[model samples]
Target: MSGEGDTPQAIRKLSPGRLVIASHNAGKVREIAELLGPYGIEPVSAGELDLPEPEETGTTFVANAELKALQAADLSGLPALADDSGLCVDALGGDPGIFSARWAGDAKDFDLAMRLVEDRLNEEPDMPRAAHFVCALALAWPDGHVEWFEGRVDGTLVWPPRGGNGFGYDAMFLPIGGEQTFGEMDAAAKHAISHRADAFRQLVAAVL
Candidate 1:
């Protein structure tokens, strides 16, 4: 983690010439682009530029986000942004927090991963089914100056999964105040209240 974005300045303070989104995931890149759209910034993806997706060796979301941001910034000579996100369950003791992406592995077979989650949690069917989605966003310049923000959305787990709209564990997690699971919600609706959107608000206030 860069530990540099402790407090947002409450105003826009950034205007870069070009920015690199340091992620290869189409879903993540699209979400980020939508977030940055109002700011008059059209960012480019690391994949489009042939930048490498570095190994996520950090222990926490912020650390991994910072690593990706710094790597892209270094390689591309442009300010870079990265997001590390996951689904965490209380009963699972946050077992998949940092290893969320890893659990999906290179091929990203989240269907198999979600099945594993149900198998593990169903073993204790009487236990609490509380869970949440967490996101950490990192913004880094080529000089290594870094800013990071983390956000989360608490919710509960459901059985048999409900929808096929979202990737990862979206089908099984239901937010605290919402009836629809993330998978069941419409894309624009989900974007407005997602964990990633929460962190992006801080990113906007701190360094848009």
Candidate 2:
């Protein structure tokens, strides 16, 4: 529930040094690493360190993110940052929100996942096509101190998908008042307005 200057209590400030990115997703790791680039933080991926992916049994994004971050921090003995993000389609009643990745199945075939979303929407054509991306970021220290920040970007779902630059459901998500879908936009442009970027900004304000 932490936002800029709105934490429940005084949170520990993150000193620049080696930090772990608790995620096995390459695209996610890349995006987070890009955000940490300007800071004096050295980014390392959990997969790179051979960290086992923890079961995401949490009911909410913040809970899952905090769980991963704490696990990584404890195992690596360093500060760790974890991100739990997902696409929520309004028509689907926020389904596939926390289960976004699982929707991709075992192979993580996002193309198939996108098609499944489309098919689900087809079942209820009268439903609204509005959707959004949610990102919850958790920064945890080895001792268990943690801070969570969340961000969201509202958008519409487009059919047939577009572009191929971004990963997951980015190809079909058009940001509000935006001409290009997240997948169509370059990394720098997407980073400027993405849900992850929004949360990262809050993290920077409160802890960076």
> Would you list the C-alpha lDDT of every candidate in the order shown?
0.84, 0.91
Task: Give the per-residue lDDT digits (tens) of candidate 1, residues 2-42.
Answer: 47435534332557567899999887898888888888776
Candidate 2 residue lDDT tens string, 84-163:
99999988989789999999999999999999999999886577889999999999889888888889999999988999
Q: For model 2, what is the alpha-carbon lDDT of residue 122?
A: 89
The true-structure Cα RMSD of candidate 1 reads 2.1
User: Candidate 1 overall Cα lDDT vs. reference?
Assistant: 0.84
- Rate residue 112 of model 2 by lDDT: 92
Q: Give the distance in Å from residue 206's predicted Cα in candidate 2 to where it truly belongs.
A: 0.4
Give all TM-scores, in the order shown.
0.92, 0.95
Give me the runs in candidate 1 sitting further than 4 Å from their true place: 1-12
TM-score of 2: 0.95
For model 1 the local lDDT of residue 36 reads: 87
Query: What's the CA error at residue 98 for candidate 2, in Å?
Result: 0.3
